[model samples]
Target chain A: MKSNEVRVARFDGYERVMHWMAALSFLYAALTGLAIWSPVLYWMAALSGGGFVIRGTHPWSGVLFTAVIGWMFARWAKTMGLDADDRVWLTRMDKYATHQHDALPESGKFNAGQKMLFWSQVVTALLLMVSGVVLWFPEWMPRSLRLVAIAMHPLAAIGSIAGIIVHIYMGTMSVPRSMRAMLLGWVTPNWARLHHPKWYREWRGSTNLR
Target chain B: MLVAKLIDTTLCIGCKACEVACQEWNDQEYTLGTFNGSYQTMPDLAPNFWNLIKFNEVQRNGAEAWLMSKYQCMHCADAGCLAACPAPGAITQLANGTVDFVHENCIGCGYCITGCPFDVPKLSPASKKVYKCSLCSDRTAVGLEPACIKTCPTNCLTFGERDEMIRVAEIRTRELKADGFKDAGIYNPAGVGGTNVIYVLNDAKQPEQYGLPKDPIIPWTVQLWKGPLKALGAMVFMGSILGAFFHYVVFGPQQEEAADEVE
Candidate 1:
């Protein structure tokens, strides 16, 4: 093998762009939303321009975030689906968390924990969008529906936010060097094989890059 | 004295002089509309019409009754609009208990409309801001009564300090009760810490009939859930960091894959 050939195509450029768009917008929406949600954090409102800007931008960015999530769901839903092995991986989430890879189930492109995060976020994002529209122009909505929407918006937001925290941490921190795939749309061949051996084997047998 | 208004629904002649006075004083025109076979004009509050008279007819024991109410903001001690507003200074609860708006500070996010139990504020697409009766803050600030109060021929709408207004409303309520109106009562909802603008309703037992909420509390979830959710966000953020640290300390990061076939 050539020493220069150190990379594997883990994500295409378009996929990486969609991923960054989702990540960046989700962060903005979460931050601006937090600023609007709590008076103590109102000072953070300046990050989105101002208090009014937070109110206005938060919902719109939420819409953008949902769209990106929708695109992500379309792209990855098949790969992220749960099977018997996924259930096993979830049952042994403790092993994965502690990097007991030998004890961990043979993961595909995404592990069970990642699948769980994806599905939870998808549900939460859809709920947020539906509830956000109710809150967006509540002047026209009946009082009862608006009240429910107002209450549920936060609940869904809380779930998605916490899930996202774990997701970002897992993607970038828990498994070190994992962000190379997301950042530059490639991972070291070694990184791919270690994290996703099944994918590596499939790719190795199908194509010879060099 | 801090300003307040008394809206005696029993005394309201449904003259709509106050409505006209409101439009005149504010220098505004109302939305175009055709009569919907009801005396109730424009259906509900709008940007143009800050004040409105709601009409209701009921058949009570072989007699037809036409009930009228001067519907507007209650200007509560704990205003829902102020609580739900995300934009700073967009909605203000004055020292006098008059809830007003600083339009320049308002961003057209309709949370206030949902927050308001009375359904007072309306979004004006033209101005792209919520507008409602500011309790004539401009006139009251100058020591003049609101245009609505000034033009009320029956002397129904009165303005004064908050305590005095409540006192007057209580007395009126007693007189109506003695007059054999069994349900006559004051409509200063206690749930919102009582409103500056009290109402002497001939039949307060059914505020819903007059399009007023029987219990006008500020939307509780908006206020209640915020603190817990904020705490949750902080905890989750910390948990992510801690979880990662613990995983790394234990596993020391996955080694570069030694499988050289792919590499």
Candidate 2:
């Protein structure tokens, strides 16, 4: 809370906007899709504006999510790649999960776990999109293709949903100030130094800060 | 007492009366006649047109012979449409053994179309709802035979108890066999748990010639997808969410160190 405290820029405005767009569309698609997947969750259709509205809107929301994720992939794929340090950090993920952050290697802007979450989402988003298209236009597809899609869509959805659950938990609960970084596009220098020391050092080096 | 309809293909004169009667009784929109180089009304059933009399020209004793059968929803006891439908109550197997589609709940996803082994259900382009034969559930509920069975001039279509219909079909099949139809048999396909709408085909061995699958079954892939795979997906979903909740409880958020604060 000091007035002289330094603020490190984490995410830009454009990145934060794209991230939220993806999050919202993903939530919409997931809820509606679950409504259609099981009788137990059939009541969810009412939450998503009923079965009729969801049938018309769910696929389109999936398209929007895929498009946004694709954009994020293009913008972040290079920096999100796994390096030697990230591989070592992956081995010590238990320490990272248990709040023993100092036991793990210094992380970059994104840690190994975060990068894994990003890549898994992108892969599953593409899977959902392809299978979703097959389901959206059943008449155009053959029986064999339809069979594969009917199974693939939900399986891929499970993958992405699992990743997002962890992503939300980590951003909001496990790590402090991480939500603020995506929300306001900056984090306190102490937060950066504790969580992503390598990135913090790079920012200091670039800015000539002691 | 499960009700059923038995169609005797041998007795059918290809009069097309039952087809017209079904259209009239159901109050379905009239489909325009299209010639496809044969007396067969339409190549296949339409969303609006629920019933059709398929005309097949096959070689019998080196001579061309016509094979006809009334084609509509088989109303399978284990209907794939009911099994594949994600929208609860959209497709249901009625107490009287009729599989009906509730138009109101239909999301028009066409999963039923994919699920159906007989390819009976059709999605309407205009309303985006699926349509098929309800076996005159409205009429049968009132203790009356289906419109198709009532209107059949040749008495080819008969409606009664499931066991009685099967017994009648067996007798007719035996008679056809005696008349030199060696392949004549009942077409109630046990693979689908026997259809409420059974058939007595003259050439049961060659049912594909009558536009019916030789051995109709709900694809195993569809069964797995709607069954165990769905359960697996639900488990994974619950596991992830619960895991996150418990992890948060056990290990609190990684708090920022006080010493890291700059003076």
**TM-score per candidate:** 0.91, 0.96
C-alpha positional error of residue B85 in candidate 1 after TM-score superposition, expressed in Å: 1.8
Residue pairs in clash, model 1: none
**Can you list each candidate's DockQ?**
0.54, 0.62
Q: Estimate, for each residue in A9-82, the C-alpha lDDT of model 2 and write its tens digit.
A: 89999999999999999999999998998888889999877897899999999999999999999999999999
lDDT tens per residue, model 1, B1-263: 56678988889888899999999999997667558888887787888888889887776668987888888888888888887787777888878779998898887778788788888888988877899998899988888888999999998899998889888989998999999998999898999988888888888988887778899888777665434656776777678677767766767665555645545
lDDT of 1 by residue, A1-210 (tens): 642266778889889999899889999988887777766777888876887566667888999999999999999999998888879888888787666788976777777887898899899999999998888877667778888887788788888887887777677666777887788877766676788877777777777665
Question: What are the runs in model 1 whose C-alpha is more than 4 Å off?
Answer: A2-6, A53-56, A208-210, B1-3, B225-227, B241-252, B259-263
Top candidate (DockQ): 2
Clashing pairs in 2: none
User: Candidate 2's error at B19, in angstroms?
Assistant: 1.6
